[model samples]
Target chain A: MKQNLFSPITESMYYILLSLSEPLHGYGIIKKVEEMSQGRLKLAPGTLYGALTNLENNKLIISVGVDPENIRRKLYKITDSGVDLIQIEIKRLEELLRNGKKVYYD
Target chain B: MISQHKLFFAWNEDKEMDYLQKMARKGYIFHHTNFFNYYFEEKEPESINYAADFKGFDKMPEEEYLQLFEDAGWTMVCRYGAWYYFKNMDMDALLYNDYHSVQNKYKKLLLFLLIVGLPLYYQLFIFLPRMSNEALTGFLFGFRLFVYFIVILHFSATLKIFKLYLKFSKNIHE
Candidate 1:
């Protein structure tokens, strides 16, 4: 396993990556994130765009080009690297919960 | 359409947004801005939310960048350089959801200001000394004064933006 340097991503970044498990356009990802977070995390357009650019630059996400239906909107999807990072993050989060539960119960 | 002359400082963009909102309430929908004047088209008196964001199109194309905002319910009003103006009928609509993103925006603006302003100051320094004796008279004197005024304006704006950047940096976690 390669070292997961991108493990500790922000809540927004994590949700964004998770939303792109299936390919999605910018606005689609925003809506999907809201659905996933149950309205708790509203990803603003500017914030989402910034994260998208950063993720693309880091090679965690790749732009799949313009949407077929909408030429204006660009689509993106998680790369293998993105999946690896997210899995690592999930494990780290589980460990955090486990540690907290242990201290609370003991 | 009517135009109102207004002066806005870099640090007080919120105030500019507020002014636009106020204008909209008075049946003057903000159309665009040309230099220091804000142009407006008359419309039914209604409240509108105005937002200003500083973002360059260097990494992303302008069309795609704008389409994202449009999809998020913000209508583009106009753009002055890298500062894009947007409006939404929903008063509660927010273009930025968190402090971290807002902080990053400020950081980008500060970086841009420094990049542009530093070179200008350097050029001014180099040219001023060589022209000092000659520039003190005639058309050169007026030209020197103009340059000084522009530099002073730039310096004040840079200072304001720096303070705003620091504030955002400190509040990033919030």
Candidate 2:
């Protein structure tokens, strides 16, 4: 179930990439990850920026632009590679759930 | 303006004590004024007197005073290093711990892999004869792939840790 190419990228990386599918600034990404994770993950500012930088370096995401009102902040959006990876991850997870349900129920 | 502050630890009247007093007096005369304040170690002093005319001293061509202080039997405990300006007067221990912990974690991981993985690989390939040469070759290839995978993971993790450290240090400075 976890055999997909994107499974090597960590759950944190997957979630972070998912968060940036829409353009998001640093804080916005953190809040989205937390909310989406159901508070299971609370990303510190350091962790969030680290993940963002890594994703950008890997070309999985690209910085869109800085908000005109807050130049210190930068916004980012997922790239084609990122969207592809997320799709792979979703398929992998779905497979895992399917196998688990079959094993448990049938 | 250059200012001087004197810290007195004890009230002994020995030659060492006398020497310190002489040095202090000379320092004052050389600068041509009593532009200094004395602080007793035991008491909380009011109004630290920072010498106003000490500006040029910071820009002094050489650190002559440092040698002079050493010659006067004063131990130079601390001096400015690379991060001297960014260092906090308090929370030094916390910052030091953070730096050392990150360094030690990397060191330990490297050490563990070297100590454990090398012998295990040697035993698997060289000692185990029942494992066919083709099987051994495949195992070695798989091992190399595993190592490559681990290298990528470690590289990513290291980048993340470094970014976290940079963010923390920058926050502290701000």
Each candidate: what lDDT? 0.86, 0.47
Model 2 ranges with Cα > 4 A deviation: A1-6, B1-174
Q: Which segments of model 1 are wrong by more than 4 Å?
A: A1-7, A102-106, B172-174
- Indicate the residue-level lDDT of B138 in model 2: 69
Each prediction's total of clashing residue pairs, residues at least 3 apart in sequence or on different chains, is: 0, 8
Model 2: lDDT equals 0.47
Q: How good is the docking of model 2, by CAPRI class?
A: incorrect
CAPRI grade, predicted model 1: medium
DockQ of the two-chain complex in candidate 2: 0.01
Q: After superposition, how far is residue B155 of candidate 2 from its true place, in Å?
A: 20
Candidate 1, RMSD to the unseen true structure: 2.1
Q: In candidate 1, how many Å is residue B52 off?
A: 1.6
